[model samples]
Target: MKNKKPKKVFMNGAIPPEKIANSIANHQSKTSIGAHSIFLGQIRADEIEGKTVQAIGYSAYEEMAEKVFHEIREAAFSKFDMTCAHIYHSLGTVKTGEICLFVFTSSAHRKIAIEACNWLVEEIKAKVPVFGKEILEDETHQWKVNK
Candidate 1:
């Protein structure tokens, strides 16, 4: 019998922008997609109630996060005729007003790309093992879970 290859999920503790972009561009070459849609999650400095959030620190439980990410990729592929997808989420720390998650999906049509991109991002936020610490401008902080 032939050996089987294990499924690979593009996951990392700290994601770099160049690598993410490279992955997307490389994945795109595999299929002649007519359109690609991308959604990025960025940090925001805002008050939660009355305390101002100066920055955010992101941490993830990687084992579970990988599982969730793989599942989302599979679902997107099965649900749409997508050429490919690339998802990267910050694991260590992400400051406010900076990108923390990026989802890029490509398909033969723009609609599918747009829909899939949106779906994947929501899934990551809800299902992945990532947590956020909202830092107040005064230097105090608190943990925040996206609801």
Candidate 2:
């Protein structure tokens, strides 16, 4: 088995840029990786009606979310020749312009890395049961719809 266990994907708040940089820096030792694809999902301040979004309050069924994430990883590995993959998502409130999701994939070639990263994001969005509350500026909120 290439993967041993399911990795924890949930972070306490927003995903930090430093963490993303360190992830790339850490892979310097892996000389076999020729390409890396990264996807960062940031909270957008979309104006709905007259109010603008301030932040997103995210929640999920942890047990099932982790399982689904692991399944997605396994499927990606089987489908693409990836060297390593990592995924992280925010759990509490993430303000506008902050990152809530990060997906990284590395491979010997560019296409595989890019394809795996995109595929993982799509699968996670479609399959994982993570819910997001779009908090508006007026203190009202609405459920986020992944489009």
Candidate 3:
């Protein structure tokens, strides 16, 4: 059954590793799930025009983004034979090497889980209205471009 409740998809700052481990541990009792796929998006310290990025400060139109996230989840459930899917993205400042996004999908088979996870990531990158400002080491900022 599709969950109709509005999911809160944004987290403040970076996603902690403990949260990831706890999520996996929570699913252990679901015996029917034969495979799981996970995606973690980490902040990178990229050098742009002689400046090195120190962190990314994220912001979004929350209402619209939540609605879009719901649509993406629904689309994934309908398009794939998946058992469950969860998405979490960071808000505010996330430093380099910190996790900013987490995508998790599980299914009875490996291929389905993998494909659904990949598709979710792509959809989010293309459709979500999340914006990031790259904070340089010197504290100057530039708008991030999704590539």
Score each candidate by Cα lDDT: 0.73, 0.96, 0.96
* TM-score for each predicted model, relative to the true structure: 0.81, 0.98, 0.98
In candidate 3, what residue range of length 10 has the lowest lDDT sum?
1-10
- Candidate 2 lDDT, tens digit per residue, 1-147? 366599999999999999999999999999999999999999999999989999999999999999999999999999999999999999999999999999999999999999999999999999999999999999998999999
Candidate 3 lands at a TM-score of 0.98
Q: On TM-score, who's better, 1 or 2? A: 2
Q: What lDDT score is found at residue 115 in candidate 2?
A: 96
lDDT of 1 by residue, 8-67 (tens): 443433345776678666864666789889887777877777878767777666677677
Q: Give candidates' CA RMSD values in order.
A: 3.7, 0.8, 0.7
Off by over 4 Å in 2: 1-3
lDDT, model 3: 0.96
How well does candidate 3 match the true structure, expressed as C-alpha RMSD? Answer: 0.7
Q: Looking at candidate 3, what is the lDDT of residue 79?
A: 95
